[model samples]
Target: MTEPRASAFITRNVLFALVGGGLGGILFMFFLIEFDHFTSTNQFCTTCHSMTFAETSYQQSVHYNSPSGVRASCGDCHVSEGIIMATYDHAVGIKDLFKQLFGADYNDPVINLLHLPDAAFASRDWFRRRDSATCRRCHLQEAIQGTRVHTAAIHQEETDGKSCVDCHFNLVHRPVPERSTFKREAWNAMVEQEFGLEPGSAEQLLAAGRRPAGERPPAAAAPAHGVGNGQQQAGLEP
Candidate 1:
């Protein structure tokens, strides 16, 4: 009797473990929805104190404070709404989270190309394509029906089955110039140094240095005949 009870207990434990494992796998498969739900919450966005800057800026942005009273949360634009799309989004999020948690210089520069995972970047473009598709699914009739400014800007030929996000991107997500403003200023300073001019002197030089060709410095005339400015024999001069 004791042996039978022990055997049954072991079997029950194994079954429970198997069931739990299966459920975990299912949740993993649909991780995007879970991630979207997490990010949708105000707590998630504001959890990091450093993110206060982004939160404040977003609040004041035209999207949040629009005259039409269309208030959208951070996740509305940044996340996919549909279940499957959200799952896909979650997969991408997992990779991004990995980079953020384990990356060498994570959060140091906040936006460094070198630190980005290739998979995450590619997945981002993929997400944009998906979002464009989502937009068209609902807006196809409207697109065909009317004359919005976008219709003119986006020729049918240009769309060619590509996502609108391919051409249109959020200002926040736009690529930073490969060179920084400081780098541009530094380059200009170097150019001025090369020309033996200071930064402020350029305006003065352009303002006062102008002279007609007639008023320009004359070329030294050929030494009057052969008596080359006293270099020739003194007797050669009349």
Candidate 2:
């Protein structure tokens, strides 16, 4: 009789433990889901001092100030879709956290400006590597009917294995050339003329990963947008 009672007690406790564990797991998952959602908001993204420049430009762009009232937050463009990719993107973003805490004096606008080129290039490259997947999340190629017929034609047909970033970059952030046409000489000149930065100062700072001075290279002309390859290089300006 005692043996039977002990067996019953063991079984009961095992069942109760399983139920408790399962409930705890669900609550933990719920917490993670809520945290992810909160982090995706524009408010959360621009909280860092480094992101203030981005926020200022984004707020003025068509993404935030559209006539149709359509608004795309920073995450909608930068963060990939689906839980797996989204989580991975957030993981990669931990670099930004580290930089904010221990990296450059990004609190200064001039110093921050020097680093913007690196950030812009890195982001554009990420989009290209991902085949501009985040852009595709909202912009379906087949569904695209641009104001110009040439634009829609470019979307559906005759092109290289080009992604959206190939042509339609500079949509939101400070205008940088599409990667294919990005010349370091042009960039150096633009920054010099635009911000009074000496040519190659950015490259030096980027190379050092901080605000260190170095020799300035000769400047050249800025990049101009070209309309070629059925790629409507100048689409509806945002």
Candidate 3:
């Protein structure tokens, strides 16, 4: 009788353990799915106390409001495609999170503007590292059969070694120079032009040497003798 009772007790405990584990796993998955969905939203991204600058400028960008009525939200560009990669991106973004919470007072337009290039360059580099995977999500290079005379050839040429942001940056933010030509004065000039800043205020900031690398210096340019010249001849870019 005692042996039989012990066996039944052990079996009951095992069943309860299995049920509890199953429920816990389901709840975890549900939380993960909901959290990933919510965090991918533009509203959630811009909810930070310091994201007003990004929110406003993004609203002004073509991705936000386009002629085709196909608007790309913040997540469409910023978030990776798969759940795993997207979570990795969010995890990496903790640096930005800490900055917003404890670093510079980005609420100030001037401060935010000062740091804008840093954010922009980081984003561009992310695209490069991912081989412009996010851009390719919407724009298939082979499918870009367009009216521009040089578009097809340029696309083919760029495919040899270039990523999309290598030549196609500055479309969505205050303009930064092409990576090949990015220098301090040039970046300052563009900032002034787009932001309607005082004619030389940015230059003055440059002169004062505040944040020497507002935009990271371009990589040493590749040889301009072949591919570079071809793009130039076609009136396109590298």
Best by lDDT: 2
Q: How do all the candidates rank in terms of lDDT, highest first?
A: 2, 3, 1
Reference-based TM-score, model 1: 0.44
Q: For residues 31-143, could you state the per-residue lDDT of candidate 2 as single tens digits?
A: 76676677789999978866776777777778789898889888888888876677788888999899888888565454565566678789989998999988887779888
Misplaced by over 4 Å in model 1 are 1-36, 49-57, 109-124, 131-158, 173-238
Candidate 3, superposed: residue stretches over 4 Å from native: 1-11, 185-238
What is candidate 3's local distance difference test score? 0.66
lDDT against true structure, model 2: 0.67
Report the Cα lDDT for residue 86, model 3.
Answer: 84
Q: What is the lDDT of residue 198 in candidate 1?
A: 53
Tens digit of per-residue lDDT, candidate 1, span 1-238: 3345666666877988989999998988677556668876656865653344345545666656778786666566555767776666656667656654654332221122122223234635665666555445434633453356666545554666666555543333222222212233332333234343457543333334332344322222211112222211122222
Judging by TM-score against the true structure, name the best candidate: 2
Q: What is candidate 3's lDDT per residue for 1-238, written digit by digit as tens? A: 3356766766977988989999999998787777778898988987884565566656777887888988887778888998778888888888988877777656544445555667777889999999999899999898787798889878876677889888787676555445455455545554455444676686565444343344422222212111222233222244
Q: What's the TM-score of each model vs. the native?
A: 0.44, 0.75, 0.70
lDDT (C-alpha) at residue 158 in model 2:
49
